[model samples]
Target chain A: MENNKIKIEFLSYSENEYIARGFVSVFASTFNPSVSWLSDVKTAVSEGVTNCIVHAYPNEIGKIILELEVNNNYLHINIYDFGVGIDNVNKAIEPFYTSKPNEERSGMGFTIMQSFMDDVKIESALNKGTSIFMCKKLLNSVEE
Target chain B: MDIKYTVSNNNLTVFVYGELDECSASQAKNILDRIINDNLNSQKVIFNLSGISFMDSTGIGLLIGRYKKLIKHNVPSYIAGATPATEKVIKLCGLYNIMPKY
Candidate 1:
């Protein structure tokens, strides 16, 4: 795989959370990140993927598309879910803000993703879907 | 993930064997809840994460949920045996700060 650009589609089920976590962890391996750096990446990816499974479809299984790319020592990840879109992006990313409080959600999904990744971007349209784009800089310096 | 626990001298230490995430959160929560309910004399809880190959925010939620329940029972709790990876997740979420480690 040149440049290590990859894409995958999977069912939006909680069980697939492991697949999502493992996929990104393996993709981030090319950067030779530290254990801590890898944990950050994995956690960020989990939050993004979990959000889609738990909230986007709301119990109904749907499709989640994941796109990943490696740029030097940097990794860029995009998780897309074509289900119920966020009504307010601003409020959604706030800490301690969750739509499903009954589920005992800590409302830290986006916060965790943004904290672990170097950059996080969200785009969503009501009744359409949401896309989470996150990037993380690996600890190991790029080898020339 | 399989969850097993050992109780000694009214103190409980729960060991998590495998990934802890949304899929396993329900089972973990149920198991933990039962332990907490049954161990009325338990003084503390120590959650071991060393065997957990993977963890996420849901893991944190599970920890926090259980911790809160213990608080009501006056049974303090802490986390232990977290590997470098699991420890990173716990520390990053500020959960380690909330619950002391042994």
Candidate 2:
């Protein structure tokens, strides 16, 4: 398949998380992914956006940019937030490691993203922002 | 998100409608907590996710949060009606360790 791309910008509000998931799922549907594959993509997108809302802009609203690109059968997602950045990306990705334990945070956001997607990468700096890039290989919809 | 609670005998079942992502987690948390508090005397708490269309890690936090609240009241929590998609997430997060499936 030819490369297709789309970008979305929205406020880092909890409500927008659902909208982000919906946008990505719809964009991915063009690939005719299976039901489980589509669900995995949606879940990964939700985790990425939720991180921006809950951790990136914890105190105030900020802008979140979601970009989707399809190359061949691979789906690429980039989620960005210009809010308080993570102090440690390695520790943040650790399972059960949460910065906001009191808020019932399971600290599984990054873990979930990594699990659902084949590739996950993070770049962030304190007081600046964070960007998470993920990719997943969608199963071919056309039968051999 | 909409939440409905049903009490039968000593068990309290909470039905969740809508996606259980970050958008609805906070509201669901408050509502579920209130329901659990109001029924502290109940022996168990069950979360019915048949109506849940989608869920992410936020759902895990919501369930774990409720599990903590119920345990404080000496009540246990169980999961019911989780779809395969939601169940995959639940198992990935090891939520069953705290709140087993019923």
Candidate 3:
């Protein structure tokens, strides 16, 4: 397999979360992954993008960049947001930890991403922005 | 997202269709709440997620929020017809602790 990459930039709106999921799922389809694997990828992408729309730009809309790369059997996803960065990355990732509990946020976005992806990383600077990098290993790739 | 409900024998069942994500959750919350409130006399409530094609933590939040609302009225809630994928998320988030799957 050869390396492939795609990049998308869009507003950090709740609706774009679905687009992000669709884009990554379609990209991962090139590997002929199983239905379960594709669903996992889509769910992970949804969480990453929702994080940006809900938490990143809580006050106003901002830009979000989604980058997808396929290398061998691995699917790499990078979701970047230029909004109010997280004040505590560690606390933010904790299970059931939410900055906006009143909004009915489950605070499981990062947990879902980490659960579905093989690797997860977060980089953020207060008043700057936050970027989430996630990678998933495609197992049992159906042969053509 | 589209939400339809049926009331029978003092029970309220909400059927949700479409992706349950951040974008749809707020809408779902409002619709579900209204239905549940209108059917407050019901003894129980159920969420039919068979029509849902995708769900994430936001979906979990939506369900949990509704569960909290129902519990306040002494109306218990159960989840029904969730796909395996959605169930995985529900279980991972411990939503079953509050609303059991039927």
Candidate 4:
């Protein structure tokens, strides 16, 4: 499955959160991910896509890009947007450190991504945008 | 998200089916709040999350919001049938401290 890769680009809307989760779930299903693992990836993908709809493009809408790659025993995910980039990446990842506390944001977006994925990396530039890279290992895929 | 609740013997049981994330958080909170309020006499509230296929931070926010309201009305709440991944998120957020899982 080293050559299987899918990329999706969509508008930044809360409605697309479900689409992202559904699409990723279907894409990862080829690897025979477990129920818990599938759910974890869906949840993480939802948060990443939602962050773009909420924080990245608060004033205006923008394009959100999602890339999925399955190689060896891992599924790699990359979500990035072209909107307002996070100013402080470190503080943003801290639990309960929501920039929009008034919005009922539990500030667990990054935390969830970190907890669910085997590895997570975030990169952002001021006024540019944010990109999240995550990977999950498929534990039960039988060899071809 | 779809929310269905049952009231019996002064207990309110809510069954949520669908994804609970930023997309559905507000809607879930509103629907659940109304149901819980309509059953003000409920002494205990139990939330069934097994039907939920996915959840994110907003899930925790929704649960915490409901727990706070339940507290104001003197109702003890419990979480039941959370999926393995969903339960991991809940436990990581320390929700088990407030609402025990059954």
Backbone collision count in every prediction?
A: 0, 0, 0, 0
The best candidate by lDDT is 2
User: Where is model 4 more than 4 Å wrong at Cα?
Assistant: A140-144
DockQ of each: 0.65, 0.88, 0.88, 0.73
In terms of docking quality, how is candidate 3 classified?
high
Candidate 1 structure quality by residue, lDDT tens digits, B1-102:
988889988789989999888888999899878877888578888998889988887888889889888888788899999998777767767887768988
**How high is the lDDT of residue B90 in model 1?**
76
The sequence of per-residue lDDT tens digits that candidate 1 reaches over residues A57-98 is 996899999999987667889999999999999999998788
Q: What is the lDDT of residue A11 in candidate 4?
A: 95
Query: After TM-score superposition, what is the CA distance of residue B63 in candidate 2 from its true location, in Å?
Result: 0.8
TM-scores of the candidates in the order shown: 0.92, 0.96, 0.96, 0.92
Q: Interface RMSD in Å per candidate, to 1 decimal?
A: 1.5, 0.7, 0.7, 1.3
lDDT per residue (tens digit) for residues B19-99 in model 2:
888878778888887888899999898999999999999889888888888898799999999999999899999999989
Q: What is each candidate's fraction of native interface contacts (fnat)?
A: 0.58, 0.89, 0.83, 0.78
Put down candidate 4 lDDT per residue, A27-139, tens digits, no spaces.
98777787877888888898899889999999998999999998877889999998999999999999878898767677888988998889999999978999999998876
Docking quality band of candidate 2, CAPRI definitions: high
Residue A26: error of model 3 in Å? 1.6
Clashing pairs in 1: none
- Give the clashing residue pairs of candidate 3, or none: none
Per-residue lDDT over A21-85 for candidate 3, one digit per residue giving the tens place of the 0 to 100 score: 88877787777878888898899989988888888898899999999998876788999998899
